[model samples]
Target chain A: MLGGGFAEAVTPLNLLLCLTGVILGTVVGVLPGLGTAMAIALLVPVTFQLDPTGAFIMFAGVYFGGQFGGATTAILLNTPGQSSSMATAFEGFLMAKNRRAPQALATAVLGSFLASIVAVTLVVFFSPLMVNLAVGFGPPEYFALTVLAFLATSAVVTGDMLRGLSSLGIGLAVAMVGIDEQSGAVRFTLGSTQLLDGISVVVVTVGLLAIGEVLHVASRSRRAPATETVASGRPWLSRRDLSRSWRPWLRGTALGIPFGVIPAGGAEIPTFLSYGTEKSLSRRRGGGDEFDRGAIEGVAGPEAANNATTATSLVPLLGLGLPTSATAAIMLGAFQQYGMRPGPLLFTQESDLVWALLASLFIGSAMLLVLNLPFAPIWAKLLRIPRNYLYAGIVVFATLGVYTTRSAVFDVLLLYVIGALGFLLRRYGFPIAPVLIGVILGPLAETSLRRAMAMSQGDVGVLVDSPFAVALYSVLVLAVVVSLVLRARNRRRAA
Target chain B: MSASVHRTTPAGESPALGDGARSFWTGRSELFVGVLVIALGGFLLIRSAMMDVPSSVSFLGPRFFPVVVGTLLAVLGVALSVRTLLPRSAATADEAGGGDGSAVSSAESDSAEAGARSDWKPLLLTGATLAAHLALLQTAGWVIAGALLFWGVSCALGSGHKLRDLGISFVVSAAVQLAFSAGLGLPLPSGVLVGVF
Candidate 1:
């Protein structure tokens, strides 16, 4: 798997693909609504005929490319391409307004590149161990794992567990729409001939993420005009920015990897947690007033955390065959399409694919740094393009992609309907990620849980039987409780 | 656009959730979520009832999981509604509103401020252009459809010079033809324009 993988990835055609994909991904990433998920989704059909590994290499490039590219938008426009970069926006934008845009941009790029390299290194070493652990998992263990994933996601995805749980419940309901494997009974098809196979993952993912996001963008006004244009300074970080940022970068990286593996919400939690930690620590460091006003540490730490979490997320996806985010979930679908399962046995069964993917990530990370750090202005200009043409182009490409997927016009109709629903949800402020997560993992979770219960003879106690299961559930409960208590306290304090 | 006015005012103003709103579940949020929850719950309950439980499996069956999750959802939904409906202490309302001042707003629009209504001119125009592109792709082909999309968005962003727009429109579509069709080997739609190639 390794030799062939490397050879395939390094092929002239494939290298160009990786370069192009990373560049495109970064460009899209710099734009607020065009995320890595959308980029990958839009390109899926275009790359359908390429060798799967080559396709994946390009996809990987695009994923990190988006991360690298997001820093620019955060700094220049006060808008973050991904939620991971939200903290970056807080500080980077401040620096921009203060005319230190170049330095902020530099620090963000450096921090991201450094953190991503470290994350890739960790993924290379730690993935095998994860695979070993996953190899021992049974149906019961998998079931427990799914429950843990669901609970963690609920606790961390949103500020309110109740609302999050409500979302999760909706997702589960959506998941239950297909035919039951054991009983062979159709559950929620509602008798439509098209519904017999259940909702397509692509349809759901595209609907919830892309189309929804477009509508969300449509609901917002143009970004407020820049009140000031601080003179562009040297691109190099100042001595102070360098000194203040290193520790935060280290701290952010430390915080990122663990969350990457946890099922809750991947980078979102860590990014915020890292931000909060850096904020408190900055005060203790006697760095009095600058922290919230675009401290270099603020930009560095979260950007580092963001990239690290993104890279390490692959660990769980590749090792345990579990997806921790929307993008990973889609990648998981790609894996299944290639007739490969990404768990512990993946390394043993598909060593070439795994290693090549790992090596490609390293290569991709390097390419991302080179492309994003120096070329940020180009991406910023991309935002200046007209929206009318952009959305129109997307619609055209989207329909064509759908048509190519099955050469069916009916899919085109479905795409429009889904797009409309997506638009509505976005307008309503309903978080759409959960819906995609729901559609992707819903079937797997239900199937595994059902199988586990059957094996246990319907024992209610089986769920909490294992120590791991108990521990996982305890963490879940704690997360929910903590979120509630924090909210309550915050509310009370506000009063 | 007014620099003096912008400089004088703060970038972010506090959200104005009134202090008298006592419940954790506000009247409006409660009403909306309550109805949704109950409907979802009712749906699950009916669906679960229709499902057959396997006797051979004893406790485990298709109906068992659905029933449990559905009932929990319904019960929680009702509980939330009840808790929200009951009058709460003034202090709590004051507290909830005061915390996250930036998050709370006095305006009814504040509830959906982050994701609310906006001018739909661009949206409608883009939609119309997309509809046309998709509808006419086979007839007009990639050259015209693709050019229209690129130019449409450029126009939406406020570029008004006709010569500049047309030049860009042609350049953009030509590039798409070269990149997607020639380089990537993906075929652009062929219509009347296909004969030119």
Candidate 2:
């Protein structure tokens, strides 16, 4: 299966798409305001014509390549493109400031490449086990899983619990628009023929992530973006640099895997944790002012952690049909767009597509390394393009991407309305991920819970009867408790 | 008109923008959002209550999940309102070694760094452009509508050379039309150019 997957992925069409995705991801990653999620969102609609395997292959490239681009910007420009790259910017920028940008870029590329390869390799081996676990999942277990997905995503993504859940509420509300699938009752459609088909996931995602982002950036202060120049050199590692980075790369991978599987709000936690670990470890080793100075370990660790999570997060999305992050959520939408659900059963049913996607991850990561490593200085030049033209192009693509989905101008109009909501949400301090998550997962979650309830004659206790459901609830409770305790301890320290 | 970008400043500039800034609502957004959510929740609950249930066997009907979501949304709205009104501790303590980054000030800080003063001019311009694009999409078609959108947004974002931006926009839309049409087999509306392609 793996060998067949590799043969399919290496096809000219898939390879070209993979390259295109990698390049697009890197471009967005280097430029601020464009995130990996938004990049994927724009493509979800545009890639509507491609086979699922090819579309996913591109998505994976964008996912991996965005990190490389984000790290470059973080290092050279002192601005992390996404939250996942924040820790990378701290030490990465410092390294650039000290005239070590090439080394920093090199470390990031190597680290990201190694981390993704490690994580994807693990997927190649253990996905069957995950499939077996997923096959056992009844509706109740699935319901509990979605519940954990929502609570954990919100809890981890935002500072305020109320705001986080509120974001989810917004998504759930949007999802509830259109007809009830079971009852044949049109719920939120106020009487337009267009309203009958419920909002498309592509429309919702493109609106929020793409068009909404354009408006959000427009609303912000347009101060000139300042970035450090990527020093012109071959972005190759030195002997000491290689030795210093490999350990952190491995450590970051280890730290990142659990978070990716658990859906604890993408890579933000693990990246920070890896950075902290590297900082303290450096101190213990009595490295001289390396924390304040450009520490290679710092950039290496977090970049590795960030990319590792991007790779491993797919496990839950593919293996269990659960999305652990916004990108994964959008990808799940992409899967459903293809008239398929990604689960272990998918491995058996549509094994070709699933295995092909997995195989392309390897090729995609290698392509990212090759594309980003030597040409770090060139990709950095993308930032020099006026922010206006970049955003303007995004607006065009967002329109085209959405309009192409169903070829309906009405859908384009719906895109703008949702885009306005997206702009409003981002303008305020609301998290956008939950809205997308809710739109995609809300229907599935509702159905699963309803099915479980129906099977058990409306006994609420049935939700907790399964050991898997109980374990999911326990994990969720533990996460909440841990976060609360941490907050309290921090408050005491502050006082 | 130029100094209107700084809405807080006293010196007169763009009255159009000053009015927009006022109407758009600033500073009390949390309250606005809270109220909006509550109203939405109320609407949801009322709708679900009035919804026709199809009779079938073993359990909770379709209304059950809507009720749960609606009630929780209202509860969340109330929580948001209360939090906004009250002075809360530990909100400020989010940064001081909060153990897990996600546990305290992780993503909020990252996103907050991007948002500063709400500059309404560009946003309003972009919004108007979007409206125009939507209106033109069916009649003027994807090529023209897309070009207008691209050029208009570029203008909003501070590009001054109109003809250059328009040329580039046309080139972009045409290229997209050709690629999507030929390569992917998705037919973009040609509008006036219907038979030309």
Candidate 3:
């Protein structure tokens, strides 16, 4: 299966798509406000023209390539393109300012490549096991997992759990539109033909991520001030830097893999943890505050953690059909767009597409190393593009992308309505991921719960009757408790 | 474009939410959220109640999940609303605690929690531009409408180069039309100048 996947992935068409995806992903990642998830969200509609296998391969490339691009900006400009690279900025910018930018860039690149290899290898070996386990799941188990995903995303993705839940509720309400499959009764369409099909995830995402972003930037006329960066320097690492970085790279990958599986919303947690671990280890080694003065371990460890979590996060998305991050959620939307329901069945049914995607991930990460290592400084120059043109171009793509989704003028109008909502949500501190999750998983969640209810003939106990479901519920409770405890701790520390 | 005026007056100031108002609304905006959610919940409950039931044998029906979700939202809305009355709801004090946001996107949450005000004029202009695009899509070809969208949005974003914006917008729109029609095989609307292409 692995060999077959490699053969399929190396085809010229797949290779070209992968290259395009990674390059596009890197460009967006380097641009402020266009994070990986939003990039994928906007791209989903454009890739509608491509075959399923090629689209998935490209999406995978974007996912991997985004990590390198984000890290480059963080090191050189002290601005993290995506939030996952914030920890990298903590130490990376210092190294760059201290005139060791070359060494910092090198460690980040090598660490990401090594971590991607380690994480992807583990995924290749372990994914089939996850699929096997998921294959045994019933409606109850599936319902329980979706509930876990919903609750975890709502509670863990935002600062305020209530706000997150509110966003989730709005998404659910939106999802409630269109025909009810079980009874063929339309719920929230309000008697419109277009409403019968329900709101397109593509429409909502483009409006929210792109149009909403344009509005947000428009509202904040004070553009993010550009900082200085070097023009022509290839990232290079000395023997000393390599010796210092290898162990941290391994440790960071170890730290990040578990986060990929849990519905923890993103990789920021593991990156911070990896950074802390490196700081302590440096202290333990009597390195005299290496963390303060741009240590190689500081850059290596968190970069590894960020990339590792990105790769491993796909496991749940592919094996279990649960998306833990916004990017993964949109990718799930892409899968559904092709009428391929993700989960255990997808592994067996769309095995060719899934395996080819995994194979391309390996190829893409290797390409990321080659493309980003020497071109780190050049990618940072993307920031120098006129903000007016950057935003203007995004607006053009936003309207075009949405219009082409169904070629309906009404959809473009709907895009603005959702765009306003997106702008409002961002303005008010509401977590956007839950809305996407609620939009994507809301239907499956409803269907599974009703199926479980129907099967048990109204006995609610059947919902929690299974040990696997009970285990998932327990994890949910544990997550809530952990969050509460952490909140209290942080409050006390702040006081 | 008036740098002096913008510099003297803060960036986010418009005829909308002020900095003082924003600070008050920042963390404490739970009241606003609570009220909006309660309204939504009420609407959902009413809709679920009015829907026709296809069967009585099944314990769960089409309305069942919506009713449950509605009730949950309503209860959450009430909780948030009531919590606002307490001393703890002072998001003013939330500065320290806000830093401890979720692992997923705490970095971004920090900015939103900062209660940064919006420049409503530009925001409104951007909205109007989209509305115009929608209105003009049928009458105006995509090239004209799409270019207008690009130019309008750039102007709203405070671009000073009007002629340049127009030129760039037209180039972008025509290029997109060509790509979509020939390459992607999805034809866009060629409204007024139908035979030009």
Candidate 4:
């Protein structure tokens, strides 16, 4: 069913590129304040200078490479290298503190790498089926889907649904800032020429996540000291760890792919849902005691789900121009940079690049596994870096990165402002993920909504007229009610 | 030896901030954030009203999207603020009690102090150096700013010594520059000295 030459096309050079990307990605991933976005931003300009295939190969490698690498910091250190790794931190850190760092790290890497490969394979083989599914989508359906996405936003992004939902609203408002496409009138731009094109998602992402993280670290510098050593545990998976992990790994993959396809706030939801599911299903490990205390399944399922969802997230991004997560949003930028438009057409138009990229996925996983699994102890050493200095460096890198993107002093200033805002949002319990989801998806959602409305002569009824749209709306309504009911029920039960 | 600040917290909860402070930090701040969001929404709504939003048939127009988003933001912001203000009863509290399952005894507190012995100078020093890097990169060039950034952050994050950290930062930045600017061909900003060899 597959071509031999294509499989073997992963030559030494391809391997070298994959290895280099994974290594660089891992280093960046292990570090705080930097993530796939920063990594991609720094690396994107370089993709232009190399062979398209080789460059794409490396980009694909680094893309997943960053995902795999982010988990290292999430588990070993409390800081997540990427936002997607946040759910991993919820349970992974507990395992680390319980002297089970080895198993936790192992399961995380293996789960991530394995799930990515599976998802990549699915993309390669079943992409056409996915496109067919996406083709059936209509404007009303999209609107309903977005509502469902919003419903899950609070649950996936933050501990409190209200905060997450509020954040989502703020995001939609930010998305509204540019021109009114249908009316051709300026809405929120207050007469700045730069506001004509709207704020670049690149600028917002780099500023909010990268710059925000830097400022956050700086605030803590005065109050906290930095440490140089992490948990000195054997990084290799023990047999007991292996025995506890395999089932959850499978369960995680199943949970991840469905949620990923549904467009409900990215992998975070699946990871959290997986965590909650595993926490419940877990047999009382210590004879009547709950598994929350150093429970291996806590680490295993969520980590697996995190990877699975991240991998499967590509389905929507490629099949439809929809991005459910921030990383996917950035990846959409990457596709645009290459002058490739995503949607149903991408599968046919960019078939070679798609396959080659898929090939690189398998290669990237192998490299990450080799790097992370065997050399996890070496990565653990990175936590030994002093926090103040680490954060201070983040400030420097974030500034330099923003400056390089546009070479404007204003951008640097923007970075600092964003950094401070990020610190405040984080210091409070406001989740930063929605802000990103907003910045990235906001424009598209608004444009689609307005476009759909205009087509129907401003009839709100048309949005629900389509059966597919009606079904989607029903799902959204169901999600909101179910989650609310579940929360109230949980509260009652606990009471 | 300087004490480490980040790792000293036994779990997500910071001992430095007590329960009242923690609740206020999380709760009151949510309310404040809600107000700020509502205000931003109002500003957007006002701006949309001023714009010449062209109308359509018997349904909504361009203003509809912004209006809907703003209204939702305002309503949700109010809900969030109100929720934060209300104190939860004992029953709901237990459900939210998921923290890292570490019992930090008084004896463990002493060990935590022992584990925290790392300096804060590197972090502060790096921040200042980075500020200098940004201020001077245009005049001094990429080599200086880039290297300073690398060296500064490494030092601030607590590398063992200046000599070793300086060497690593220099080599790393230089290699990055060569790969990015020379090999791949995306020209980095050289600041003030443009085209002057």
Best by TM-score: 3
lDDT of 4 by residue, A228-281 (tens): 225566666778778878888888888887766665655656777787777777
Candidate with the greatest DockQ versus the true structure: 3
For each candidate in turn, the TM-score is 0.81, 0.93, 0.94, 0.77
> Candidate 1 vs candidate 2: which has greater lDDT?
2
User: What ordering of candidates by lDDT runs from best to worst?
Assistant: 3, 2, 1, 4
The CA lDDT of each predicted structure is 0.66, 0.80, 0.81, 0.63
Judge the docking of candidate 4 as incorrect, acceptable, medium or high: incorrect
3 or 4, which is superior by TM-score?
3
* lDDT top scorer: 3
Model with the higher lDDT, candidate 1 or 3 = 3
CA displacement after TM-score superposition, residue B46 of candidate 3 (Å)? 1.2
The candidates, ranked best first by DockQ, are 3, 2, 4, 1
lDDT of 2 by residue, A1-495 (tens): 899999999999999999999999888877776778878888888787787889998998888888788788888888777778889988988888888999999999889888999999988877888988889888899899889888887765455566678888888988887878877777766677787778889899888878887887787667755855647666778899999999999999899877788777788889999999999999999994888788999999999999888888888888998888887888899898888988877888899988899999999999988888888878877877888889899988888888888888898898998888877666556677777778889998988988888888878899999898999899889989997887677677758
Q: What proportion of the true contacts does each candidate reproduce?
A: 0.22, 0.46, 0.44, 0.28
Kindly list the per-residue Cα lDDT of model 1 for residues A14-130, writing each as its tens digit: 778789888988887876667777777777776777777787888899888887666787788776776666668787888888888888888888887788889988998899888
